[model samples]
Structures are given as structure tokens and as C-alpha cells.
Target: MFLGYHILTKFFKNGELSNDSPKESYLYYEKNAIDGDLQGIIQKLDYLKELGIDLIYLGPIFKSKTTHGYDITNYFSISENISSNSEEEAKAIFAKLIENAHKRGIKVIIDLVLNHASKEFDFDSVPKNLSVKTESPRSPQEERWQMSFLFWNLDDEDTREFLIRVGEYWLKNFELDGFRLDHALGLPLNFLEEFSIRMKKIKKDVTILGEVWEDEGDKLKNFNLLKKFKGNDAQRFTSMFDFATYDTIKEVLGKKNGSLLELYNQIVLSNQLNEKEFQLTYFIENHDLPRFIDICQDIETFYITLGLLMALTGNVMLEYGNEIALKGDQTIHNFHESGRVAMKFKEDWSEQEKKTFNYCKNLVDLRKVHSSLSSGSYELINSEENLLIFKKKTTYDEIKVLIYTGEQAYQLDKEYFDLISNNKVLKLKRGIYYLQ
Candidate 1:
């Protein structure tokens, strides 16, 4: 039942946009770190524990030209603008940050952008086997604003050895818990296997999460793509973030045409509970997608989706600004700024923001106390009209979840305990209810 939190390191503070570069060097300026003074994340460690997070997943921190460090120029050094320190000083600061996180019982994993590097990378440092190769970009709108990246030659042995050492370096030097491999879809199976093996060898319990989804394709999911990451007990990725199910959740919001059954079925078929070799991590929002509240439109409906997401039988991650319903929209012109907004704290929260934060905190706390909600197995009990019911159970503990996402009044079959309100009731409508 533990929760994971994702933080876009640069835009993590409230006044982040104010730190944009004074003199533009590229198509767009840096968001929070261009000769800037925004405080580093290590100072805000207490904020994570207050939200019931057990693991912290960070966006890229490597040296790069853009605000988002996905196009890394140097894997060995920490980004210069993130702090006021020199290159070597920043690495030492990062290592100490990991030590403090371990003391607080929070595991830390970072994004590993293996597919490409900033064209600014010094190529002479590596072997002569590599060459300059530029492929067509993925998202068309951000092309002009984005930095030109040099695609890696996965077929080359020297390239494989070079990238793998990058993964091993962080684990060995910083005692990092794991990595979330960015853009991991349809990678050569052999390279993926070798990469996973090399990472765990540095730390046996390292978690390697893959971004294996094709939302541009369809909701049915590409088992052909996912099968590449699924492996045996000896060597395999620890889990995958469930973008397919999140797509379905988006459909059910605001009395939409979609049904929760599609989401349920997607999970059951994704990696059946009996198959322990792989697992899925479900999230309502992330740095890439639009904010959950922005999509829900109604405050109550936003809470309903948040409740439904947390109730699923898998791991969950809460992006940094999501606790207070932060807003961002991806588009052709400003795609990165769309979702990677600065985080808000308690001192300056609106009533709706406070409610959303508490509602999320309550759902997280419920999972901690209820065993069935955490490690228990899942089964569909009922789905009639707007009401869909499911059960989570172990041999001794059992809990049932009732959700009403349709418009108009709904009736309860029996007296039920509303986990959200902490009260018993016999009538319910358009909300989430968990009963023992």
C-alpha cells in the first residue's frame, strides 16, 4: 500500500517560473535553474513524509542544456544550475541527500534517459564506434523549443557498455535505490535484459520501472510491446507505470461514456495477480500528462477519481504538485511547462486545494491501516449502471469498494461505512465507498 511520489526537480518550488534564464541560450529558457537561487529539494524532505509517501521518484538530474534534463550531456556529473556549487560539489551534495533520505525511510529512484543525449555531449570521451545520428522527434509541437538529441546506437557493443556504466555509477556511488528507465517501449529485448542485470548487480534490490505504453496507438494495450520488458525471476524489470488503465480512468470522469469495467479488465489482463514476475504502478497524473483536477472539471468528481485510483490493486505514484491540484496542459508550443509546474505548500492553499490534499492524504492513510487494501487480491463483485463494486481480500481480511460515477441519485444495498466521511450510512450516491 506504499505510495510513490514524482518530483520535477527544477519546478518544485512555488515561484519557479520567476527563475527562468535572464539571457536565452536556446529556443526556450530554463524554468528554475539558470544562475538561479531556488532552494534544492533536500530542504523539503519533510514535505514527502507528510503526504504518506514511501518512495520518491525524481525526474532527470544529469547535466543538460534544457530545464528538463532528459537530454543529458554528461551522465557522470550533476547539473550545474540545480545548485550554486561546482560540478564536484553538486555530486557530493546529491550523495548526502541520499544518506538523509535513507535515514527517514524514504527510498529514492531517478529517471534514466537512455534513448538519447544532448547534441552538446563531448563525443571524444567515448570510443570511436559511435557516430552522430539524428532521428525524427516524437512530439511535433515541442520540436523547435526542444534541444537536438543524438540517438544512441543500441546495436553497438561499445555503446551498451558505456550506457550501462552510467546506471552502475549512481548505485555504486550514491547508494541510490533504483531507476525509472525513460522511453523504455519496444527496446531490443536483449539490451533491456542486460541493462536490468547490470543495475541489480550493483544493488540486488534495485527497482527498474519501464515506461512501456503506446497511448497514440489504442486502449487495448500492446502486449507485443509490454512482453519485451517482462522477464523471469532472475532478471526482469520490477514494475511498469500503468498508462493504459489511467487512460480509462480519464474516460469515466464527468459522467463520460467510458466505464470502470474497462479499467478493471485492463489490470486483470495486464499481469494476472498470480503472475508474480511483474507488477503495475497506477497513477492519475504525472509530469507528462494533464493534471487530474483539470481533466475532472468538478471538485467532487476529482476526489472520486483520486479515490478510485488509490483503491486499485497495485502501486501508486503522486506527482509533486498533484497534492494541491496543480494545473498544466501539454501543447505544441509549451509542452514541458504544461505539466511541470511548481509545488504549493500549506501556508498558501485555497479551500479546494486543502480539501484535495486532505482527501488524498485520507486515501493514503486508509491503505496503510487496511491490509486488504494493500497486499490483498482483487475480484469484481458487481457493476450495475453507474455503480461498480470490487473486492480486495486476503485469507482473513476482506474489504469491498463501491463507486458511483454516474449523474443523479444512487441507492445503497445495505448499511455501509463511508471511508471518506468516517461514518456509517444506508444511502449513497455519486461517490466512493469502502466497506469491511
Candidate 2:
């Protein structure tokens, strides 16, 4: 049986993560960057629900020094910077947030940094032999410090047990759905397999999403490594964010001369390489890269890209504020911080922002209703220099998406229902057109 069977049955009808269901739609929120307390997050659950978000992936909430919270100091305590005045109060708020989310049928996944801890992590309690000595500075200007990898000494029983306990404590006590492991590529494969086994033992429905980014060549080579890590019982991870897709989308959409055929070919190649049993999460923007709006500038191009993302198969993840077209970059001193901005609620949004938000909301709703767009077989119907047309077909339905980036308008011969507007027949201009 699949490990997350309970979650699949409870939230999805297909018994798997598919684009047709709301369960696969993930919204990433940075606790520190967003303007809200733990209670504020709870209050916003209804807003997220309205956006068709079923899973909320929170950036590191553990005690940390940085605004992004990647440099975790304590795995057990909530960050004081983003939480209540007292640790006890913070725990209460965290518990309430999870409870409220579950009550609304939404799952919660928090970021976990297992590779390394903050400089202030209490390593005195850990054995010296378990830590790794490095000459490289911890930060840009900081002095070098000894860092302890959770399983640096693979045979160390103490470290293994400690990390396992940490994983279990959150699931058991907080009733959390799972974790989004940070820098998963740097961690040991053996440890990942073991950790998955232990976590499944606690809650079979728990989901584990890893962050792995690399070039196409390295990614293909690493697929073998991932398969081996899963071993006989594939329990390591439910899925990984599709960085390969992100790279392709970035290359084509970021530049003015990016080819539509080039983007189609890249998607076809990545889909061919994906493992049958595992799912790949797709996203246009995250905390790491520059915002999508900043890269694609034009509103028409932005809508086309968003439409393509919604049409693609697999779980779709949207960074907070992406719907509003928020712009920022890595050049703002702290690179990650530039991309991590406060959530822009609809109350204070401009006309353009409102239009973008509505467009995204419609796409999310469309994906939920159309199984072909989410879990169907894909085919490249037509590919040209400026226009690319693709079809997603399942047993029950079929969806054809036409993307036009050229300056001239294009007309369709047949009349088909427009998926985006839900009112008009198919007639293409210099933008994205979806027909069903």
C-alpha cells in the first residue's frame, strides 16, 4: 500500500496526488516575511481555502537567527521573532494553527534543515567525533566554525535516534502532515531511507517533500541515486519540487527571445525522465529564485506562463504573493530575502493585481475540475517558432492549451469552450488560450 494512503483517500478521489484534486496544490508561506502572528495564519486559513490551496508549506518555523529561518537554532522551539512573547504561548499558537488547518481539511508541512544547524546550536552535548571540521567561513564575513551533520558518522546511533525523534515529535504531538526537507541533495542517502522508514512507522500518511536542484545532466545521473536510495520499499519521499521544470521555464520565459518550441521540448524531455511511481512538484517561483513577475515583465507573458503552469501535470506549488505579481530579487543584500516578501492581501491590491489574482484563482479551480489537465497523458499537438499547442487527455476529458507569444493574433477554425473565461468560444490573440 502507498504510505500516504489515508491522506489520499481523505482528500482525493483518485487515491494519488494529481492535478485534478485540490490536495496537490501547495502554497508556500514564509512565517517571518508574512505580516502575521501564528493566530493570523489561522485566521487566513479561509483565505487560502478560497484560493484552492489544500497544503500549506511553511518555511522554517524553528528558532533561527536569519529572517528566512534556514539557519535553525532549535528544532523543538518556535522562533521568537515570528511568534508569541513566551515559548509556551508560541507552542499553543502553533498547535492551534495545525488544528485549525486540519479542521478545514488542509495539510501542513514545515521546512526542516537537517544538513546543518545555526552557529548557536548546542553541540557540546554531541560527541566531537560526530561533527565535521571545515575551514570555510559559516557566512560571508563570519569566521569558520565546526558543523555537525546529522549523520556525518553514519554508524553513530545517537545522532540517528535524535533526528528520528525530532521528526516523530512534530507528527505525533502537533498532528502535522509532513515536512519539506531543506537542502536534501547535501544529506546522505542512507539517512534519508532510514528516516523515511522511521517516520512512516509513526504515521503512514505523512508526506516528505525534498528540495533537490541540479543541471539536466546531473539530474539524470542523480535519478539512479534516488531510485537506489528508495531500495525495495520506496518510503523515502512522496515527491520533490521539479527544479528541472523551473530551470526550463526560467530560461524560456525570462528572456525576450525565448522560443516556445524550446520550452515544449524541455518539458517533454523532463517528463520522459520522471520515475513512474514518484510525483514531481511544479512551480514558477519559490524563495530561492527571483520572482516570476520580475523576470517576465509583460502582463500578457505573465498570464501565458501561469496558464502553462496550471495545465502541466503533477503537484503545483505557488509561492506567496505570486498571484499578485509581487516583484523582488536577490540583489537586496540577502538574496533569499528579496524573493521572500510579505503576503499582499486583496484588500489593498491594485486593478492589475486583482486581475492577476482572479486569473490564477480561475486556473486553480479549473485544474481541480479537469482531471485531464492534472493526471492525464500529455502530447505536443503543434510546435512553431512563436506558438506551442499541447493536449492533456484522460479517459473522461481532454484539454488543449495554446500559447502564443508572437505579436500577431491567431484564429482557431473550430469553436470550443474557453476554460479560463468559462464563457467564450476559442479565439486566440497574442496570449495564452485554453480550450476544452
Compute each candidate's TM-score over C-alphas: 0.89, 0.82
Per lDDT, the best of the predicted structures is: 1
The residue-by-residue lDDT of candidate 1 on 1-436, one tens digit each, is 3479988776675223333444455433554332322245676777777888889898888877777777787888777666434766777767776777787889999999887778788666454565434455444422552457766767777777888888988888888999998877635678889998888778887888888776564555545455546666325578877766676777766336577676667756753622454567778887766677767777777777777777776678888877777766434234335666556778888898888888888899988777677667889999876788889887877878888876777767677777767999777767888875
Candidate 2 residues lying further than 4 Å off, grouped into runs, are: 1-35, 124-155, 214-234, 273-277, 329-335
Clash totals in order: 0, 0
Runs with alpha carbons beyond 4 Å of true place in candidate 1: 14-27, 30-39, 124-147, 222-224, 271-274, 329-337
Candidate 2 Cα deviation (angstroms), residue 366: 0.2
Pick the TM-score winner: 1
**lDDT of candidate 2 at residue 95, scale 0 to 100:** 88
lDDT, residue 255, model 2? 61
